[model samples]
Target: MNATDPLLTVEDLNVRFPTRQGVIEAVRGTSFSVGRERVGIVGESGSGKSMTGRAILRLVRPPGEVSARRIDFMGEDLLSLSEREMRRIRGHRISMVMQDPKFSLNPVIRVGEQISEAYRLHTRASRRAARQKTLEMLEAVQIRDPERVYQTFPHEVSGGMGQRIMIAMMLIPDPDLLIADEPTSALDVTVQMRVLAILDKLVQERGMGLIFISHDLNLVSSFCDRVIIMYGGRIVETCRAAELDKAEHPYTRGLLAALPRLDQPQARLDVLERDPAWLKEQSVVAHV
Candidate 1:
């Protein structure tokens, strides 16, 4: 279904939100791409990390305008596509796993129905077949007792179950590229690792590219192949996951310092120092 191709390439993208107060440039000429591998986008709150992901999906709402000199996916310019065309591509070839499952899920609808609806949007399947696949997806994500979980509503399930259901829905279509915008942010620490594991298995087994956007440096360092650290709406550093320990950029080094270590016996964690250079903002490097 993925077509064994380079999935997406975004170049010189700019996103801005117009408010009565002022115009906030959420993404400042950002550029990146995803092959059939895992890439992570990391930044603090209001650093424009999430905005970059949303821009790629063209999910920015009204009052927020997304303009990119070029945004290509599978040799197609996404910015040039009609909303109808984007709708067809969304959830079929490309899917997004939002941060919170409850907000994304329909409270009135059963979880199975919600996922089946996703399947229906892309496939002309009977209710029976879609239902079957829905349950199969739950099981595939390692959720126990698929039948019981399938019929459950958003409120009926725990937070962890809800996140798992979100993963199931996103993966049901076997999307070529998945933009996970802080996918496990809502889950507890224990559940977070489990969900990350599920994602890793899916990416490895399905051969799909993943754009993991999060503020958790440690998690991204371990979960992704390459890390993109954004600051003030721009990419500050790019490095291999393993090389995160040796990130070159000053902003990146500060971010690494900001993480509280387990071994250090200290009364309190030290806040990170921000460089004036990071505040200036600059271009991101694409080594691969």
Candidate 2:
């Protein structure tokens, strides 16, 4: 594939659930493409950034239904793939690093065992090989004393370390695409930077595509190559990260205006005003 070609394309994707109260559309007609570059999805809580990621992976269980005009990944139709085929693609070709390591990690198993199991399941590696790979992955994520961390339980590690461990586990299978849903949200400033740096290095080195879902507009603007702004389950704007400050959409402008600036301290931050009409706007393809 050419460098300009997209690694994944999602068109008119929708995720809905039939609750007793009514139908809830968590994601509505969202569309975007991800190439071998860092793409950030930013929105406030309930904006459907995480739901979009999960829908692409077909991880939304029953009671929740995912429908898409097209969801193509590496020339294959993800929406059309069987569960068994998707199982082969997941982790091996694509992986997801979910928010909150506390709940994502298995309490019964050691950290190393969990990571090793992921590697072993996706590949033909033996137990010893998987263990070695797991240690290497830990070290790759800049975890010092990989040997000690290898035997520790999830609860034994700090939040930052646990998040790093999750990253390592997701990347161990050498996936082509990684969807990180608020991967660094739980960490402090220092740890967040380190974890992001690790991901940046790994993505660049391995030539993998990334979908970084977060609520922080400033972080996404600084770290990602492109940014997709969603509101009320729809994409309100898409723009190059460097040009995010100049976004033309009212919703995007509102979000940018709401961000607190260190240089210009204000007594009160401007609250984002939402317009119901913005939800019906056509999705913007990636742009300047």
Candidate 3:
């Protein structure tokens, strides 16, 4: 692929589930692109932020259908690839860091071993080499003692440490794209900033593209180069992070106005006023 091309380009993506109620559309006609830069997808819960990420990776399970006009990654069509071909693309080319490491991590395995195994799986390195690389990655994520953490089980580490370990595992393969789904939602403010710093440094140094999904608008606006706002299963607006405050869409404005601010105190936080029309409106294409 040309260096100027986007690392991933998704067009008219949709995810649907066959439920007892009816066919529920989790994501509706969302279109976006990721270059070697950070792109934030923000919305309230069930607004399709997470579904969009899962669809890009083809992780949506059976009975839950995913269809797109094109899901081009590095000039290849992801939607057209077979299951075997897609497996090679998953961790080797693209990786996802799920929300809540407690559920994502293996309870029976040592944290260090898991990370080492990930590296070994992709590189087919010797145990000694994988171990060395794993330790280096742990330290790179700012773990205090890689030796101790490596020997300990997943339950032994704090939430922040677990998150770092997850990041280390996902990044070990040096994938072209990283999809982080609320990777810091469970951490405190101090720890959250630290994890964000680690991610920021690694992405810049490695020249990898990032898709950060979260419900925190302020966090997205501050950290990402560009922001995509979703509402009712569709992208309502897309803008440069610096220009988020100038977004004209009512859904976007409602979301912004609803946030609590220390500088501008009010009697109570504003409730986001929802419009039925937002569900029927066309999704705004992202500017990569």
**Highest lDDT: which candidate?**
2
Candidate 3 lDDT score relative to the true structure:
0.89
> Quick one: ranking by TM-score, best first?
2, 3, 1
Residues 1-288 of candidate 1: C-alpha lDDT, one tens digit per residue: 254456888888889988889998888877777889899999889999988888888999988999988889888899999999999888888988887865789899999999999998799789999999999999988899999988889999888888889889999998988999898887789999899999999999988999999999889998899999888788877778987887766667777776777786533334546643455554446464
Candidate 1 ranges with C-alpha deviation above 4 Å: 1-5, 265-286
Task: Give the per-residue lDDT of model 3 (tens digit) for 1-288.
Answer: 554569998999999999999998888888888899999999989999999998998999999999999999997899999999998899889999988955698999999999999998889999999999999999999999899999999889899998999999999999999999999997899999999999999999999999999999989999999999998788888999998888877777777887887888753435545553544464454354
Clashing residue pairs in candidate 2 (N, C-alpha, C atoms within 3 angstroms): none
lDDT of each: 0.85, 0.90, 0.89
lDDT of 1: 0.85
RMSD of each: 2.4, 1.7, 1.9
Worst 10 residues of 1 by lDDT: 267-276
Instruction: Give each model a TM-score.
Output: 0.92, 0.95, 0.95
Q: Candidate 2 lDDT (Cα, whole model)?
A: 0.90
Best-matching candidate per TM-score: 2
Candidate 2: segments with Cα more than 4 A from true spot: 267-278, 282-288
**Candidate 2 per-residue C-alpha lDDT over 74-141 given as tens digits, one digit per residue, 9 for 90 to 100:** 99999889999999998789999998955699998999999999999999899999999999999999
Candidate 3 ranges with C-alpha deviation above 4 Å: 1-3, 266-288
Count of clashes, each model: 0, 0, 0
Question: What TM-score number comes out for model 3?
Answer: 0.95
